[model samples]
Target: MDFNFLSPVSDLVLAHNALLSSQALGSKLRIHSKNQGIPDLDAVGIAIIGVLENRNDVNYIGEEFNLNEIRKSFYGLFPGSWSSVVADLGDIEKGERVEDTYFALKSIVSALLKLNIIPVIIGGTQDLTYATYRAYDDVIPMVNIVNVDCKFDMGDSSKPMKNNSFVGKIILDEPYNLFNYATIGYQTYFNSQEEIDLMDQLYFESYRLGEVSNDISLVEPAVRDANIVSIDLNSVKGSEVSLNQKFSPNGLDGKEICAIARYAGISNKVTSLGIYEYKPSKDDEMTAMLVSQMLWYFIEGVNLRVRDDDFADENSYQKFITLVDSQELIFYKSNKTGRWWIEIPFLADVNNKLKRHTLLSCTHQDYIDACSNIIPERWYKAFRKNSV
Candidate 1:
């Protein structure tokens, strides 16, 4: 247990409770309060960990951040009807160098995943997402990442890693494990024209903030299909929270962001989640509270997850095949949840992690589009990527 890398939570924060008649979340969380004592990994399915390294943020240089307020805000909330056990494993202090912090985070996240414990990370900067992606190297052969941000962070990979461009490192790095990368709630103005065009050149997926906010359900399929989800706090509008850095005038609102968090949580494939680029300010309790609510909703979604990945169970889903552009498109509708998935044909003798006839999550509209002789963009992308 690389629990040695973690620092225990202070008793003061753990002791703080919201004024309520019933028990609050803080009263229920098992805390890592002792140096040698850590929460029992077997007891909890979700482990909350905070990172205090923010040197990578381009704008907020030398600013300090601690997750104590966020934890207090989260722990004060009422827990929903959930079955999975949760524990706060405490925080990871910044190391002598930024890489040291990344290494510790990667090790901790990887260890937690090996124990079947999903890590809910409270991060200092979005670049920490690089470490989270690296944690999947040996654990899973390939991964699909869904980033919820206002801009595509695929900055110059040739340059050093920073919060603004860490995604480039994930894509260009060794072992080449990244299969698909999708960005939801991206505002075009924040991104460079080259980055936007690169997104197309790489066969990646990007959804405009308007497209998703207009129909919140549109984000469901992308998040549902991801194995890892990284959400930048900057993706939320400035009106909703105090702007420390990575500020945006227009982005996903409070309810919309929480809904996306729930979508990421409900995904059976999403093993790790990180909420990043958050800077705590003394005057704003609302930002901490919002982050806490987002965490709560994610946990709620995890507990409410339905396992419908097994398409072989004929009684569990109805299968439909449509012919469009001389290609057969297969779609599956779950009987339990009515959720939909479109099948991507398997390429034999190809180096791939996805199994034969992979079912990609999609919306009802995608099915309707296919029937109208239109090939869903998601289906096409998956097919092209899988064949590569």
Candidate 2:
């Protein structure tokens, strides 16, 4: 396979196995190199692709960009009880133009997805998520995006796109493939009032940094329902990262972000994940270690995935019907995972991209609210969004 867009990892990094008396990930991974060519996708479950493009990062004023620290930190970690094969597809160097880089990333990610290989992207700028989302435009008719960040990143779509404004581009672009957009760990101070208002008006979801930090489990349902998940490292507090530019004074902590990544990985619907906005400094060991652990948790979650998509089987789920304000709401609980989902019915005359009815991931609390004659916010939003 000729991947014109990719540049293999340096032999120095691949050959750096000096550490002794330890089982490291470098020993297990099938890495892209001058001699190895490309790894067999059929035998791989996840592929790590690094994008060294940071022109859009708000803090990056120059041309320097790297993910070498991340590779060194990640490759040194020991593997868990994981049976899935992983490959490091090397880095996509910054092209002459930013658009060229986007095109390469889109092509690579699309190809990997077709092979049922999840691409774990470590990126220089969060805006690369726009390219990741575009890769699925033709492959899937509709997609749900989950962004773990401190800001909404929905800048003025009318202006030139940047790291902070790419979500707006995704919304305004052609095909209109976005079904739902959800944000986790967003700080109220970072986003403008207009952006916050827009999220509510569009019937999209936004969870505050306080809310998710207080209850990390709240992110699971949002991530579980998403097809693509993007995490901006700037969402992490400054104390956790060695690079101060990419850190925040009050955002998600290290543990919370890793837990969120695991939630994303456990979701059967999620196909691609990108971690961006990392700024490597001279002392980047701590930052790289955190990123490595986050990746470890995500892989752990993927290995623990249960096939509970089949709700038709009575043996796999328990059904419950509740009447909320005279409207019927059907809920299903997965026997395998104890997860809950509510069905949102579509009107027959309505032209919707979704089917006649769709199952929206919910919590047991939502089911209880329905029993008390209260419609869950999730159901109401899905009901309205499904309308043409």
lDDT of 1 at 291: 93
- Superposed by TM-score, candidate 1 places the C-alpha of residue 205 at a distance from the truth, in angstroms, of 0.8
Candidate 2 lDDT, tens digit per residue, 1-388? 3478889887777766445224788888888888887776778999999999988766567868677778888888888899889999999999998899999999999988888899999998999999999999778899999999899999999988899999999998997899999999999889999999999888899999988988899778889999899999889988888965455689889899999999988999999999998887878888899999999999889998998868778899999998887889999999998999999887888787786678999999899888888898888888888885
Best-performing candidate as measured by TM-score: 2
Computed on alpha carbons, the lDDT of every model, listed in order, comes to 0.88, 0.88
Error of 2 at 139 (Å): 1.3
